[model samples]
Target chain A: MIINARYIAFWGCTIPALQPYVEKAARLVFGELGITLAEPEGMTCCPDPDITHMASHEYWLITAARNLALAERRGLDLMTPCNGCFFTFTEAISELKRNGKKANAVLSENFNMTFKGKVRVYHALEVLYDVVGPENIKAKFTRSLNGLRVTIHPGCKLLKYEEKRLDVKLYELTKLTGSTILTYGLERLCCGVPLMYLDADKAIELRTKPKLDRMKEVNPDAIVVICPACHNQLEKGQLMISEDEEYDIPVISLLELLALCMGFSPDDIGMYLHRIPADDALEKLGLI
Target chain B: MNEIHPLRKRFRSLPSSFKGLLRSELRIGHIYELTDLTVSDREDLGLPSKPPTAYSDPNALEALKRIAKATNLKKDTGFDVDKLDFEW
Candidate 1:
């Protein structure tokens, strides 16, 4: 389908600063799909999913509401690939709606602004799966990864949050590139971000490592994730673990895969930035 | 998270629902359901380590109630907070 669509690309804190390659890949893929990832000025971090929530519920709510307010003023729905940002926005919006009067009062008194909760917040996978859709995603598949086996982290915000409920679109999106999504026992575990402030070792030992250990048994070509923090955790977790001692599975984003499938070369689509090189995965698919 | 919030002290002792969501934060394990296990549960099974805590954070229920309750706008008007559980 030939048409124009626009979304306020909520880059949040991680992607632009630590993970620009994700932005590069997402841009390339979205450009190819004819979707516009608009960047409106004056938007800040989703603050954080766990940190802000734990540190100050009030400040977390206020900061997150600010980003949504900016997007709402723009009349465009917010879209983000970071599950943390997605959680912040989605959770904040939902909370604001449920308690509009009180939230508005607090926000107005402190920041001289009100959150009407008008705009919709969406994860990148949600937009791709629900808006761009599987059929269209399939139509753009120029390089097939049919034999490539991948593991999906799906991200916590998209899956577990009680209100935001999990959906199958991320699964469907991963399958669109013709890659196999390897399922394991600990597939739904956290990335250790919440405990990041409390204990780093515990986050890895308890969450990331066990899941990686189990995924090690499956021997997938790469791990696919929709969230940036999870992307960093899984990728960084491998580096933290002794590759000689554990699974050093490569991690890649959903947009990167879509870019590769849409005829973009590995280097052009920002594959080199991954901690564990995606070269092997791309070369295996003959997209090098 | 910042230094000014109340949750910093409350995090360790938050209700079971929060604890359940902490361990099963991604909802992949479903801690409240049969899928998740505690540290002792893991040890009993001969697993190497205990799971970290991080479950689905209600996403909004607590925030809504907290905000409303703070402003004295909360009402029992038959609005079930339990219905907030299925929001994904």
Candidate 2:
């Protein structure tokens, strides 16, 4: 199967900070698969978080519309990995498609630009799951992650955006590459990253603490995160909370795990960036 | 392309209150259906049956105390008092 190599690798604000490891792994794997990811110049912050909080409903529409316009101007479909960016782009595109004239008019007036209303935005997980087949990912695994237990936290944006509303199907994609997925009571709860900006204590209480407790019970070797925001929040939040508590499970990007299973070194995949060291797992795998 | 625009405009033009009603319906209309299973739901789903106990190591508490004190000092001093009070 031939996959098109024309899509833009859209990295919002968090990407530069959190995605070097995953991005490196992705390029290596995609190169092997004969797929090329293009990174366009002059792409700015998606402005989703800011617009959502500071702007009026109309202004939010224009802010997101401008991003879509920018991507469309590049003549490339936007492929975003950040859940917040994906939700904002997807929701903005959907809204504009639902109301193009008003949305385009507002965008034009605000940003001095017009959008053709013809770009498709995809979340990285969607690209990986649908475009890059799970069988292909399984085939890339030279090192089996046999005994290393993992828990997946599909942030609210990822699961909530799906049309069918099924949990098992949502989780099945993450469990595809022969790893034991730990199922815990608070599996579906938010990681509280979204609420961090609103109420830090409550968000921690409601989101991270519960997951930590649940993870301690299951004792997973690591936690797999899909969203960059969730990854940061889980890593920093876990470290902060662990200072008060005891368990210290490492948090990792899902792509990093895929790279590990494919026999990529910890340094090769940027595993050193993690707050909680994955050396214990690497030692167990004898890759250290 | 033209077909989608007008319908969306009309949809958005409805009274804000009417839109609120639609939003409410969208939020509450779904009644989730559950599948019948013989095993205990938690066991069948492999979900943890009980909440995990909290780990309270003394060293962790000391570290947390040090962090809290540092954070409090940072907050009180505003990280950079000169910058906070600066008039540029």
lDDT of 2 by residue, A1-288 (tens): 566656677655454434455556555556555566676343434544422323234434554676678678878898877777788787777778888676566546545567787899987776766777777767767877777788878777777765733234336555765568988878778888756655678888888888888888988888887677777778777877766897678877676777777777887766665668888876776778
lDDT of 1 by residue, A1-288 (tens): 874889988766456544556777888888888999787355544556774365346655765675677677778988888777777777788888887665567757655667886798877877777788788878888777799999888766677664443447777777878899888877678877666556778998899888888888889999988788788888888888774576667888888888888887777755666668877777788776
Which is the leading candidate under TM-score?
A: 1
Off-target runs (Cα >4 Å) in candidate 2 are A49-55, A106-112, A164-170, B1-88
Docking quality level of the chain pair in candidate 2: incorrect
Score each candidate by Cα lDDT. Answer: 0.66, 0.59
- Poorest stretch of ten by lDDT in candidate 1 chain A: A40-49
Record all residue pairs in model 2 with backbone atoms less than 3 Å apart, i.e. clashing: none
List ranges where model 1 is wrong by over 4 Å: A102-112, A161-167, A243-246, B1-88
Cα lDDT, model 2, residue B8: 52
Scored against the native two-chain complex, candidate 1 gets a DockQ of 0.03
- Residue A222 lDDT (model 1): 95
For model 2, state the Cα shift of residue A70 in Å: 1.9
